[model samples]
Target chain A: MSGEGDIKLLGMVVSPFVVRVRMALHMKGVSYEYIEQDLFNKSEILLRSNPVNKKVPVLIHGGKPISESLVIVQYADEVWSGKGASILPADPHERAVARFWAAYVDDKLFPAYIGIMKAATEEARAEKAKEALVGLASLEEAFTQSSKGKPFFAGDSVGYLDLAVGCNLFWLEAIRKMFGVTFFDVGKTPLLAAWAERFAGTEMAREVVPDADSAVVFAKKLQARFGSNTSAK
Target chain B: MSGEGDIKLLGMVVSPFVVRVRMALHMKGVSYEYIEQDLFNKSEILLRSNPVNKKVPVLIHGGKPISESLVIVQYADEVWSGKGASILPADPHERAVARFWAAYVDDKLFPAYIGIMKAATEEARAEKAKEALVGLASLEEAFTQSSKGKPFFAGDSVGYLDLAVGCNLFWLEAIRKMFGVTFFDVGKTPLLAAWAERFAGTEMAREVVPDADSAVVFAKKLQARFGSNTSAK
Candidate 1:
């Protein structure tokens, strides 16, 4: 783990993925140059760094770039090991659990959230919202099981799982307002709701997380493009 | 990296996910009990161990279960570090690359392959097949760039990306035969084709990979259940 050279982050302001990387960097106390990219007209650096997905945030450390937010977060943890709060736990099983849940956020929860906002009809929206609640309930269970009375997913401090799921808070709140539906029920997912609030109230999160108003505006634009009877898939 | 207790794998025979765990175990030369589960009538162990996804390739080490194939593979590398051939590289950047490609296999290639085989009509199948080929081409580029003249994805040793992509070879071959279409074209993906052959021919792979005939049989059954226009998603 060497802090040898310049570090740069290629990202977009609106992306939750980008926010995840920023949170990880802040948690690790690593300094990096942040360069915002235009998603519609992606930069050469972004495209070259991540040709496969062509998305942000790409972390360029010492001239080499790493794509995928979770991947970059893991890289940051390894490269900056022992510098600050450890993102993943020491135990192998616990580390796997962290990865599994992180993957779950992307694989299951995000899609469900998008489905809720993008569904055409009220009935479809309700169904999608219900599905999203199911995913949230599972996440709530994860938080409860992983941290008994601790503040975050990986015990007392914010860790990998927190960064993974916390990025969605802005959009989740916006969807709650726009659709008049409560996905993270206090009765059902009390732990998750509390965790969400705690995560949002953190100084790092407050600084890094996109503004809720701006997030809502972005969500509305996304809905216009990806919502309704259109093939959002 | 202590080898302290009994290791048991709960898995289904036809699963590439299960195969991944098995390959990692064999690469590490770790002794483990392999217990095959019936997907139709899933065992209590499978359900109890991985209640979240309830899918197999759950590696139970010293009574704790680790779900998700790639996650388990990573756990194996960590727990059995310094034992045998390292699955992931030592460098953080290289490890991230390995992880990125492995995730790509799950996120992109597998889905495209499934889409090709499960499409409803010939036209849809052709389109899906083309999409799958596109993914394969990208994989080919990955292999070429990562390993210039080396044998495997990790340059000589059959590492993480090799196992991740190699597990799908059985099903890919089966699809080719069933559909009379060649997805892994020698002309288009010469390096990948050679790598696939090299990987398949490995002694470790011979022991872990499901036989082609058995894979085809399982694929047909899957096709019956998940194929055609009946909500493959």
Candidate 2:
């Protein structure tokens, strides 16, 4: 470790994963230098820090780089323990539930969203859209049950699962506007939708989450990039 | 939590994911009932416990079910803290590295292994085999750096990363035997190969990991199941 309080975040503005790291930092009231990375042409720092995946949202604390958004979030919680809101619960079972949902967001939800974005035909898009909705519905139920009638996934505070899911709200909204598709239905996923709104309204989210208009442009560009791949659907 | 020791693990015998949980339990000396579930025809209890994925290796403690292997491993480490060996590192950066590699095993290495197993043609198999080797080479480098001249990933003890990667040894050996192809070359991935041997020789691995002969039979059965899907490659 370097000197105390040395923290740097390497990420792109458009990436939901990066937003996750930012949200965690914001929740913890921890300050860090944010370095914007060009995804197309990655810098030496990005490549060196995360050699395995070479992906972004690398949290450099005390000169040590921690990659993977969730991993970074957990590291933040541990290192900055007793500072700001606790991302993961103190209870082991509750912590497991948070992790399970976070993994679900990456493993199931995001893939389903990507499937819709990559879909070539209307039929394929519809199928993928349905899958995405189903995933959102599951989150709705989780929020309904776990939130205890609170705004966030883990009660009143925006915890680990909240940051994991809520950080992607901009991207979700961008996709909705760009494709004229609704991934999270207000009626079906009322709790999750409400949580999204509550999360977006937070001071942390206001400061960290990317601008809506720019995110939509990025989403459109991403859709165009995926269009080149015929088998993406 | 339920009672003081009311823990039940729902798992399948041959699954590496299940073995991971078992390894954690064994290391922690946590006594729990292990119920083997049929993957082909999943039981109601299994489905009920893990409604989202409906997959195996669900840790049911105090009537609450925790799905996902890695999540369960972390939970075991936390709940049973100070009881036995700490699966995760105390240092934040070290813990992040462990989590990264464990995630890498799931997100990168396992997929490459699957690609090789699902390859239809010899040429495709050769390509996937090369990719799988590259992944193993990366793991070998990780072991060389992280092992610190010790046996396991987290030094003398078998920690999270060790259990994540090492538990799959039986499946790897089974695939090699069935296909008459080598995935982990002794010369190429000497560290990883040695680690595999070291892991398999351990008392825990010997007791938990399925026998090589039986694993081969299971591999053959899996191949047969995949045979119907011509586009598996």
Query: Could you say which candidate leads in DockQ?
Result: 2
* lDDT for model 2: 0.83
* lDDT of candidate 2 over A76-126, digit per residue (tens): 899889788889988898899989999999988888877766777778878
Model 2 chain A poorest 10 in a row by lDDT: A224-233
Candidate 2 lDDT over B1-233, as tens digits, reads 22347899999888889989999988888889889898789999999999999998999998999999999999999998978889998888889899998998998778876676677777887787787788888998889877999988999978889999987888777667656668667888888888888888988888788876676666567768866222321
Clashes of each: 0, 1
Which candidate wins on lDDT?
A: 1
Q: In model 1, which runs have C-alpha deviations exceeding 4 angstroms?
A: A1-4, A223-233, B1-4, B223-233
Q: Give one digit per residue, the lDDT tens place, for model 1 in A117-216.
A: 6677778877888888888888888898777689999898888899999998988877777776776677888888888889999998988998867777
DockQ for candidate 2, please give it: 0.88
Candidate 1: docking tier? high
The residue pairs found clashing in candidate 1 are: none
